[model samples]
Target: MSKGQPNEVTGRIFDGATLRKILAQVQPYRGRFVATGVLVVLLSGLVWVRPALIRIAVDDAMPTGDADLLLNVFLAVCGMLLFEALLQYRVTYLANWVAQSVSLDLRSKLFQHVAQFQLRYFDKTPVGTLVTRHVSDIDGIANVFSNGILNAIGDLLALLVVIGTMFWVDWKLTLLVLTPIPVLLLATRIFQRVIKKAFVDVRNQVSRMNEFVQEHVTGMHIVQAFGREKQEAKAFAAINASHRDANIRSVWAFSVFFPLVEMLSATSVGVLLWWGMQDVLVERMTLGILLQFILYVFMLYRPIRQLADRFNVLQMGIVNSDRVFKLLAREERIEDTEMARAPEQPIQLRGTIEFENVWFAYTDEEWVLEDVSFRVEPGESVAFVGPTGAGKSTIINLLNRFYVHQKGRILIDGKP
Candidate 1:
């Protein structure tokens, strides 16, 4: 895709190659990444351990009326909580450090690539678009790691561990508790679709808003001088409204989806309670097991709901990643040859220039400087004046190598 090409939000959210390219940026911090991953795994286990300990306390200590056993479980829970908190802190710090570092490296690389692009590239590409790539888009990518990717992994791990424990206690009750999973998953799918489109619009609107603001501010003098302040202001307001509407759409999707998730969660818990109570009456299930399942349900739905939210972050990051990668992949219109180099020592130009039978045009077959030839010896001063739209400025531009003249040789001190 070209630099200014719009990103399509449908179909696949992330291209495999594009994603790989994005992850490759983290290769420099592999050690930190491994450490973060280990911490996440440990934290996930610790999260599940709390409910397991509670189950043991209720089942073993309470049944036996052993206060010492109860106190030991309580102390162990406290100790585990403290340990989990410490590991969680380390994990968050490492993830954020990697994220900020990646953002820094990515922005620097983007700026360097953009700098190498010829002047014409900038002429066609808006400054606001570039700013979005460097600033907002890169932030989105950082979010993928800090909040979306690794954190989502931890969420999934927690969900799996909770499910596993639920089944270990009672598969029948676990299945009963999970009856709402399909509904929640379907809602998540719908939310993903709605949010994808909303986010795409949000990004586009942001770019447009930036472009409009930048253009107006740079040309504010012209706008006010022509008594077009009201017109420009109206235009700006319209764009601003578009930006706001796009963002609101995303928020609205969230507002709706989260409540649905909560409702489903409540329904699942209600069903679990109704079924578990029947089993308790029959002596087929213990109160400790029932309580453990209730805790597990909270553990389960919390991550499920959070998974949906984190998926949003992941999707936004992918969208921005697509744009940033496209910019990086853009083909430069002008590039110096391998042999191109500056002189070893500082030397003053003799000011001798020649344009031999040069043919030039900004567009096809519409010549601005057709079959043009000129020469000026050292110390000579000459002016070629012409009306507007004539090739006067083109001559100066070609002489300075800001543009390359077609169809002939342009020489300085008789060397091309």
Candidate 2:
């Protein structure tokens, strides 16, 4: 398998709203997602309680050397930590199972559709294109449903927790931390177009590379015979260079977007630190609340970065889904009209054929046969001798139903 291309499917894919609609396939997981969410909620509560625990440790428990209070905090913290760890494990396990299931379903559907597609559809389409859909697109979609959706869930819940902890601990610090979201959103929206295009370019180049390798390997003999190996080498180098450039562009865009997001997150932490210190010295906030706020801030960022990263993968998947869906959506042609089957008691008949008023045309502008006819009865040795481009081979073609007659009926064993 090719090392699937970088994401070339970004800007042109379905919008975020549309992507969510497609993600509705995971609707069956509503119960699981909700359960996980509740776990996360409980987990957040544990996180929120830590500040108070610290306050007790620093301000209350240690103040008068209260050994009993310290022991209680230690036991409570250990219990909450264990539960949180279990929740994390459950969510991760469930998400992975869901990811594998969805990817398998998508690939199976796509394969069924492609299997039924008419010959004409595949005439101009490269096998590489289809392979990309099966391999890359399916994997890309798996990436979306797996890491993308899971991270999104975590991000959303974490955001709620962070906000809640903010208000509960220090709304002033929360306000400072979140003030950059709108600005970041605006910035993301602005660069989104470029980032999407860069990703698409990378995927396209990778696909072309796959196609190139396939063609070259298949035609190795031709290259050797024609003594064009050196020239082909240069051609391949150009393709490799194109692939490299596309990856560079994608990486460049990613570098810009991710760091900017990180910076926005960093700035929020810096602002929170400055604002919280003021409240701290003035006795408006306690040491424990500030510690919880910092942890919440750390928790807040992971999802932000995850969402951004997953968006790119989701975009790539959506792009591939279009092609896969096209394959799945195609209508079959050239099906047998009769429920034909091999007879239980088959009779072997000698080869013979007959055409009655047979007419044929490979295209509209010319008729290889026009209202013409022929008969080849059994035990009669007959030969068709005509100049090239005549309907000689066409009669044979019609007899086999390789090219069905447009007018008049064909009689094979006295059957049309």
TM-score of each model, in listed order: 0.93, 0.79
* Candidate 2 colliding pairs, count: 3
Candidate 2, residue 159: Cα displacement in angstroms equals 0.7
Off by over 4 Å in 1: 1-11, 337-340, 343-351, 363-367
lDDT by residue (tens digit), candidate 2, 1-416: 22222323444544665476447656766676567556655655555565556667776787689999999988887877787789778867766677777778778877877776654355445666777778886787777766665566666666676678677766667777788889777776656666678777777887787776876786789889999989989998998999899888878877887788889888878887888878889998776667667777777777666666766766676766655665566665445423234567775666557677767776553778888867787889888899999888887766655555678877656665
Q: What's model 1's overall lDDT?
A: 0.84
Candidate 1 per-residue C-alpha lDDT over 352-380 given as tens digits, one digit per residue, 9 for 90 to 100: 88889998876566789888888999988
Q: Which residue pairs collide in model 1, if any?
A: none
Each prediction's RMSD to truth? 2.7, 4.9
Clash counts for the predictions, in order: 0, 3
Whole-model lDDT per candidate: 0.84, 0.70
